[model samples]
Target: MNAEQAAFLLAHALPPEARKDCWQRKFTRAHRSDLKRLGVTDTQAERLARILPAIAYYGTHGPSLAAARTPLVILAADAHKAAAALRVVLEGRDEAMQESRGRLLQAIESLHPERCEVDPARASFFHSYDHREPEALRLLTALQDVEQAAQHAVGCMPKAQTRAVAHTYPVELIDAALSLDGPAFHVSASAESKFRRVAALCYVAAGHGEPLRAIRAYLRERNASPEN
Candidate 1:
């Protein structure tokens, strides 16, 4: 089998369980000839064995998985940031809240009937009671309500945010081939060349679309590159 035939075989030859496990112990030094028979060099086969799991992972999830997940990932991050900010506010004596309270108190004090002349509209209504006292009471009541709301938010916030989150999904096979970039999918230098080719073929094998002409053109460019 030539490289093209080998690529086709590699797309479907491995067992599902073995593919899922990335053919870990399944391919050993003893199976070098098996890979050689499929037109893969011993060095290339070794690299291929190492990268199979990543390829299988991409196959299982498909190319569009990352695009589908990106928006939700960003939203979750925003929520986490908002929650963290809220936690900071509720977990301590908030300086801003204290500042606001001070301002409100000063305003209420300045508006007191004793401090300043009461407005005619205010002086006429139940002239016996001071409106400042009721206003202060209402402010305190509103503060209590805010405190209760903050407590509820504290209870609702996640106890521990995951330190490591894979917000960006691994780059797909077709994408890696098209871009000639696969670091996101962990494609190592040893396996880079053949892996990109086979990965693109596998993507086509999965019935995604007729991109063979583009794939061929890309391969030609890679072959002509100084790095290749």
Candidate 2:
């Protein structure tokens, strides 16, 4: 056998079970035909048979000495690299959660309070406090307060201060945040109505749209009906 083939034969020869019983042998010897195929002389074949060996009892089925041992070291190294890659991916995902948190907060603050309707009952239900502030604060408070829920929706505690965040925010991200690049509106409604729509869209994008919309809808319906 060649040097590489010889190494494989030696590396895989000994089974642990064979170690326990010396009589138990691991055979990896090339057959006469195998040596013939390799153009091995009878003397060379005899030498190969002597060194290349295997145990008697094994998995019961396998290739003859012609079989090459697995490249386990390379495989192990690859697996280790793959594991590290996954760790990096997980860390990045956590960082993204932080970024999302920061972005959502920024979005709330950026929203002009005078423009939106922050329904008091909805805000109170979410915040568990009596905040009658306009829609911007209510929405901001909602994002701030729902830490656990945000982590669940986003996958972890969210990101940095405004200045660092501002550098990160590209024009595309801003457009996406506002959906300003989405369908343009010809608003004939009040400022509150227009702002409420924007607020709802933002909250929805933050992954907590259900509760936000529910409250908004309830308040709208309530407002539409005459007070008892």
Judge candidate 2 at residue 214 and give its lDDT. 37
Candidate 1 per-residue lDDT over residues 1-228, each given as its tens digit:
134534444455444664543323334454455445434554554445544454444334333544544555555555556555544433346788656545655687776646443455666654564444455665445555555555555456554443322211112223332222223222222334543444443333332233344444545554676975
lDDT of 2 at 151: 33
Query: Which residue window of length 10 is worst by lDDT in model 1?
Result: 164-173
* lDDT by candidate, in order shown: 0.44, 0.35
Tell me the deviation in Å of residue 85 in model 1: 9.6
State which candidate has the highest lDDT: 1
The whole-model C-alpha lDDT of candidate 1 against the native structure comes to 0.44
Residue-by-residue lDDT tens digits, candidate 2, 1-228: 134443454445445643444333221243355434433445443332332222122212333322222233344445455545433432345777656544544555466534444555576544563222344344444434443343344333233222211111111121222232223222212334433343333233322222233333434553566751
Using TM-score, give the best candidate's number: 1
